[model samples]
Target: MEEKKAAALSAEETSAAPSLNNNTAIISSDEETQGWSTQATKRLLWRLDWHIIPFMSLIYLLCFLDRTNIGNARLDNLEQDLGLKGVQYNDCLAVLFPFYIAAEIPSNMMMKRVRPSVWLTFIMVCWSAAMIGQGFVRNYTQLMVTRALLGVFEGGLFPGVNYYITQWYCRHECGFRMALFFSAATLAGAFGGILARGIAEMSGVGGMAAWQWIFVLEGLLSILVSFTAYWFIFDYPGTARFLTEPERSEVQRRLKEDHGHLSNDFDLKYVFQAIKDWKIYIHMLICMAGFCPIYSFSLFLPTIIKNMGYTANNAQLMSVPPYVCACFFTIAASWFADRARQRAVFMLGFQLVGIAGFSMLVATANPSVQYAGTVLAAIGIYPQIPLGLAWNSGNIGGSLKRGTGIAMQVMGGNCGGIIASYVYLSRDGPRFITGHSILIGFVGMAFFLTSFMTIWCRRENARRDALTGSSGPQELTEEQKALERELADDVPWFRFTV
Candidate 1:
C-alpha cells in the first residue's frame, strides 16, 4: 500500500493524473489517446507532408520570386528602359520594405478574424496580379505602385501561415513544417534563377525584354496557384472537414498538450499583451539582426553571382546552388530539431554557418572560394529563420497572441529588407566588400541575441520548476497540465521547448 501510494505521487504520475483519473483511467485513456495520436500523426505526416508543404511553399516562392526578380531584371536593361539611374533603383527596393512592414500587423489581424482560405487566396491573387502589372511598367512611378501593392499583399503571408500551422500541428511538429514551408522560398530562388536565365536568353520574344518575360510568366503561375490554394487549403482544425471526428479530437488534444495554452478568436488584447512582453522586442531584434544580410542577398544573388564571370544565363544558373543548399540544410536541421524538440541550439549553429560563409566571402577575392562561401552562407542563414519562428511560436500561448507575436516578428525582421537594399547598390556590385562585411557583423549579433534569449528562458523555467517542486525525469507544470487539455506536446508537462 505504501509503495503503491508513493508510486502514484511520483512526479509523472502526479502530474498526468490531473488529466487522467488513476491507474485504470491511465491505461484506458492512454490506449485510446495513443491510438488516435498515432493515427492522426500518420495521416498528417502522409497527407500534409506533400500537399501542405508544397502548397504553402508555392505562395512563399512566388512572393520571393516577384519581389526579387527585379534584381534579375536589372541585368536586362530595366533601369535604362525606365530612365532611372544612380540610387533610384535601389531606392525602389528600399521603399517597398517599410510599406511591407507597415502592412503586416493589420493584414495578420484581418487574416485571423476572417477565414484563412478566403483571406490568403485573395492576398495571393492580388500579389500575382501585381507581379504581372510589374511587367508592364514603363517608368518608376508605375513600378513603385506595383512594388507597394506587392508588399501589401505579401505582408499577410508570413503571419497568416505561422498562425495556420499552429492550428494544424503539435508544438514539436511545427519546426519541421515551418522549415518545409520556408524551404519553398529557397526553391523559388532556384526556379527563379533558371527561369530568368531562360527568359532573359529569349528576351527578344515578341519584342519583350527577358526581364518582362520573367515577371509575366512567374505572375501568371502565381495567379493560377492562388485559385488552387483556395480550393485545396484547410483552415483550422474545427474548419477542417477532411479529417474524421476522432482525428480532429486527436489534433486538438495533441496541440493542447504541446503548448502550455491555447485560445480561440483573434483577440486584440493579446496584441497589447504581446507588445508589453519585452521578450517580443528581443525576438524582434533577433529576427531583424539575423535577416539583414539574408534579405540583401536574396534580392541581389544574381548580381553577386554575375561577378564570378558567369554569363547572364550562367549567373542565373549559379543562383540555384545557394538556394538548393538552403533548402537541403533547412530540411535536415528542422527534421533533427523537431525530432529532438530543440530550437535554440540549432539556430545558434546555423547562424555560425552564416557567419563563416560571409566571413569567407569578405576575406577572399577568389571567385571559386567566394562562390562556395555563398552556398554556405545560404545554408547557414536560411534554415535558422524557420527555427527562430517556430521557437517564438512555441513560447506565445493563445492564438491571438501567436498571431500578434508573429506579425511583430515578420515586420521587425523584414526591416532588414530595407537595410539590405541600401547596403547593396549597383555600384557596390561585383565585389561588395562593404555588403559582405555588414552581413558578417549582423549574423554575429544574431548569435548573441539567440544565446541571451536562451539563457533567459532557461532561468525562468528553473525558477518556475523550483517554485512548484515538480522537476523530475519529466518536467511537469500545472499550466502544462491545463495546456494538455488546452495544448499538447509528445510528453506530459511539456513546457515551451524554446
Candidate 2:
C-alpha cells in the first residue's frame, strides 16, 4: 500500500506527466475538489493539444497559403497575364506588408477586448475573399489592391494566435506548441506546391488562366475551412467544453501557479509598458535579422529554382522538399528548446545554420550545389523565427505585454519582407549574389545581437537574484502577490529567462 502511494506522487515515475517545479511530488493547490494526478495533467494537455492545435494550425496553413500562393501563381504566369512590368510585381509584393504591419498592433489591442474566435473569424473571411479577388485582377493596380487587403486581414492571425497559445500553456510549454502551429506554414508551402500544380489543370475552365485558378481554388478551400474555426477555437481554458468543470479549475490553477502572477483584467498601461520596454525592440530587431531570409525564400523559391535552369513546372514540384525538411527540423528543435529551457542558445545556433546556407548560395556556380544551398537556407531560417517569437513570449509577463511584443516581432519580420521583395528582383535572377550576400550580413548581425541579449539577460537575472535572494518563484502573501501581478515581469522575483 505504501509503495503504491509513493509511486503515485512520483512525477519522474512517468514520462507523460507535465513538467513540475519539482519532480519529487505532484503539485496540488488551495482547492482540489476533484482529484488531480499526473494522469489527469497529461490528459488535460492532450485535450488542449487536440482541440486547439489542429484548428489553429489549419488557420495558419490557410493564412500562409493565401499569401504565398502568390509565389505559386507567379510561377504559373501571374506576371504575364497581368502585363506586370519590371518592379511592378515587386510592388505588388511590397504593398501588402505596410497594411499588414499597420493592422497587427491594433488588432492585438482589440484582442484584449474581443474574443479570439470572433476576431479571427472576421479576419479570415475578409482575406479569403480578397484572395479570391486576386484571381480576377487584369491590371497591376487591381492586383496591388487585393494584395494589400490580404495583408490587413492576415497580419493579426499569427501574433494573435501566438498570444492565444500562451493563455492555455505556460512558458516552458509554449515554444513547442508555437513550433507545431508554425510547422503548418511549412506544410502549406509543401502542400500548396502540389495543390497549385493540380489547380493549374483548372486553367481555361472558368475563362481564367492557371495563375488565377491558383488563387481562386486555394482561396475557396480556405473560405470553406474558416467557419469551422468559430466552432473549434476555444476562448480560454475556463470555458473549454471538452474539459469537465473540475478539469477546467485545475487547468486554470496550474497556469496561475506556473506564471506566478495572473490577471484577466485589462489596462492601457500594460500596452504602454510593452511599447516602452527596450527588450521588445531588441527581440524585434532579432526578428528583422531572421525573417528577411525566410520571407525571401518563401516569396521567391519557385522563381529562384526556375532561374537555376528548370522549367516553371519543375520548380513548383521541386519547392516542396525544403519546406518538408523545415517542418521536421522546426518541431525537433523546439522540442529540445522547451526541455532544455534554453531559447537564445538554440536561436543563435539556428542563425549560424542560415548564414552557412547563404554562404553556399553566394559561392556556388553549380546548380545542384545551389539547390542544396536553398534546402539548407530554408532549414536555417524557418525554425529560427518560431524560436525567436517563443523567446519573446517567454519573457513578457502580462497579456497586453505579450500581445504587443508578439505583434511588434511580426512587424519587424514584415519589415524584413519589404527588404526581401526588393533584394531578389527579376533582373537579379540565375545567381542572385546581391540578395544572398545582403541576407548573410543581416543574419550575421542577428547572431551578434542575440549573443548580446543572452549576456544582458543573464546579468539582469543575477542582479534580481542578488537583490531579492530568490532565483526562482517564491511563496508570497495574497496582497504582495497582487503587486507582483500588477508589476508583471518587472516584479523582483520574476527572473527573465535568458
Candidate 3:
C-alpha cells in the first residue's frame, strides 16, 4: 500500500510539471514558504556581497597593480637602468600575455577540482612572490622570467572569480556583481598611479630604485592579502559553512527556478559542447575587441599623459581621474544593465562611446582635448567589460560548460593584451595616431558583433518559447526530471538571456 501511494504521488507530480507554454507553477509551496521570499533572497545577496565582492575585488586590485606596474616602472627609469632598447620594454609587456593566455583554461579546470579559496589563494601567493621577484631582477632576462611567472599565476583569477560569482547569483543579479569585480581593475588603475608616485619617492631606500620599491611594497601587500583571502573566500552554496542548511537549500532552489538545473559535476562532455558552440567564439571576438583598449589604457595611460607635456609626477597624478571616472561609470552602467536585463545593447552603446573617444584622440592635437578623450575612452570602454562577461555567463547554463566557455573567452580576449602591449610604440610618442586608429577599428567591430549576438539570442529564445508538448518539461519522466536538474541551461525549458 505504501509503494502504491508513492507511485501515485510521483505520477501526479509528473503530470503537474510545467510545460514550455503552460503557466503551471513549478516551485513547491514548501520551498516558497521556507525561504524563496524576496526579503530572504535580498538578505542572502547582501550577505554574499558583503562577504564575497570586496575580497574578490581586492585580489584583482593587487593583480592589476602588480602586472601593470611595469608601465609605472618604465616612467621611473626602468628602461634606462636595464639598458632596454627599441621594443624591449614592449617585449616585456607582451611576453606575459602568452603565458597568461596559456594558463587560463587549465587553471579554471583546476579551480573546479580544487576549491576556489584554495586555488585562488595559492595563485595569489605565487603571483605575489613573482611580483616580489620582479623587484629584485637586475636585467631583461630576469625581468622577463618574473613577468612570465606573474602571468601564469595571475591568469586564473579573472575567470575563476567570474565562474565563482555566477554560482551565487541569478542571471539578472550577475551584471552588478561582475561590475563590482571588474571595477577593481579601474580602482587599481586609479590608486596604482598615486601609489606608484609615492613609491617613486622611496628611491635609494635600502639601495633600491623607485621601481624596485614599487614592486616590493605592492607584492608584500598582495602576500598579506592572500593570507586573509584564504580564510574569507566562500566555496559554492552547498558546501559553504557560513550559510545555514535552509539558506543553502533556498539558494539552490532559487537558482534552479531561475534557470533549470545547477549541475556542479565536472563533465568532459560539457567542455566539448562549450568549445563547439559558435556563440563562445563570437563572445571571444567581443572580448578581444573590448579588452584591447582597456589593457592598452591601463598599461600606457601614465606614459600617454606624460607625452602631453606634463612632468612624470604630474602624469602619474593625472592618470588617476580617468580611472576614477571609469570606476564610477562601470558601476552605474552595470546597475542599469541589470535593471534593464539587456546585455548586448549596453555593450554596443558603450563600445560606440569608446570609439568616439578614440576618434577624438586620433583627430585632435590639443593636449586638453586629448586628455578629455582619455576620460571618455576610459568611461566608455571599462563599463562594457562586466556587461559582456555577465552576458556570456547568463547564456551558458551548465556548470562545466560555463566554466570552459568563460575560460575560452578570457583566454582569447587576453591575447589582445599582447597586441595592446606592442601597439603604442615609442615612435608613436605624444600623438599615437596609429594606436588610436587600431583601437577605433576594433571597438567598431565589437559594436557590430554585439548586435549580431543580441539578435541571435533573441531569436533563439523565441524558438525555445514556441516549443510545445514533450519537447517541454511537462512530459519529463521522473528519471528525466532528475537528468534535467543536472543539465542546467541545456534543458529545453531554459531560455537564453538577451
Candidate 1, position 11, lDDT: 15
> Candidate 2: what lDDT?
0.81
lDDT of 2 at 301: 88
- Candidate 1's TM-score reads 0.88
The TM-score of predicted model 3 comes to 0.92
| Best candidate according to lDDT | 3
lDDT for each residue of candidate 2 in 383-416, tens digit (9 for 90 to 100): 9878888887877776666788789988988898
lDDT per model vs. reference: 0.75, 0.81, 0.82
lDDT of 1 by residue, 1-498 (tens): 344334322311111001111011122233245555566578766665665667787788888888888888887888888999788888878878888898888887776655667789999999999999999998888888888888988888877787677667766677899988888878888888888777877778888887788889889998999888876776555445566666555655555454333344345666776777678788888888867877888788888888878876788889898999899999999999988878999999999999999888888889999999999999988987889888887776566666788889988899988888877766866788888888888888899999999998777666555654563434335665455434322233334456
Which window of 10 residues has the lowest lDDT sum in candidate 3? Answer: 13-22
Ranking by lDDT: 3, 2, 1
Q: Residue 106 of candidate 3: its Cα lDDT?
A: 87
User: Which candidate do you rate higher for lDDT, 2 or 3?
Assistant: 3
